[model samples]
Target: MASSKKSVFAAFTTMEIVLMAMLATANAVMTTYISPINQALNTLGGPIATSSITGIYMIYGLLAYYIIRKPGTAVITYGIGGVVQAFMGTAYGIASCFVAAACYMVIAELVFAIVRYRKWNLGVLMIAGGAMVPIWFFFAANMFHYTKWGTSILLIALGVRIVSGILLCGLLTQVLGSALIRTQLLRRFAISRGQGA
Candidate 1:
């Protein structure tokens, strides 16, 4: 007999959507509130400029993916995060949100797919999050005039993004996720399901 267990889904369940929404919304609020601080950091120039706080934006999506362990979770979570951020109002406006959502989600999904979604370990998660930066930079270059910064500065920004991805999205997310698992709050989700908790 075939096992009842199945792989990731193309579509999410209602519960999954709700979970994603909550996480994404919280992330948006945090991100929006911190925008000014990050902008001020940008004035300082070099890697510190772009690397200041934006990495935290990746938190919700990374955590959602950890819990859901599903194919489209990253996209839906991050996309909703972008919508939430836009609705909450930001200096970058809605267009930036849409572009960011699209770019980050696409790259995140691709990286997750490449790993076959079998690995939820730190390094894999870091790679998935880091993968998003190139597309982020691509769109940001167009949307924010990164070209004016010169190649060296742009490269530094890229390094900052990758480092942030690993630290904020990967490491911090992993630590938080493990804590959530221990709380048994996620018992009904994929993470717990996998753990047989």
Candidate 2:
């Protein structure tokens, strides 16, 4: 009788850990620059800034998940990135980014778990990206409650964020992931090893 081969990458390798750390740290540094730009846009009457920044914030998880495809990768990457950003003293405060990253990953991880992590197509990406909206609102409402922003403005912001998440994080990630797959740079990962499915 022939025995089936156990998956070679059931556990993360050192290279994978290094890749995760590099990506997470890069994400944290990017946040330091992106957040101020977002605030500036908001001041200039650019309400869509929320959507843009959220999408940008979400890219790290999307990229990390795409490359790693391991369970809990999103949570770990986002958690580390968030902590790093908070410690770096982003304008939004450490607690805000920390909570935001935690919530975003929770929603994303739940969707991935339900799908058994099999589907990495556009539709699934869209769902995963869009799922962060509720968490965004939860955190935003808490932070902005003292600002006394009207319901109409809040609704507009939510709408913008949803659309942005779908486009920037969902569709864009799919496109970028496809590109990455084509470049053969991800050959070391399971997605290139025919084990992603």
Model number with the top TM-score: 1
lDDT of 2 at 19: 73
Which regions in candidate 1 have their CA more than 4 angstroms from the true location? 1-5, 195-197
- Predicted candidate 2 versus true structure: per-residue lDDT over 1-197, tens digit per residue: 12222343266778777777788889888877777778788887666554555677787787777777777788888888887787778776667877888887898889888887767777888888878777867676888572366777777778778777787888888788778889988888866765444
* lDDT score for residue 4 of model 2: 20
How far is each candidate from the true structure, as Cα RMSD in Å? 2.4, 3.0
Model 2 TM-score is: 0.87
RMSD of 2: 3.0
Top candidate by lDDT:
1
For model 1 the local lDDT of residue 44 reads 75
lDDT of 1 by residue, 22-136 (tens): 9989988887678777777777774447574556877788889888888888789988988888888878778988888888788778877787777788888777767777787
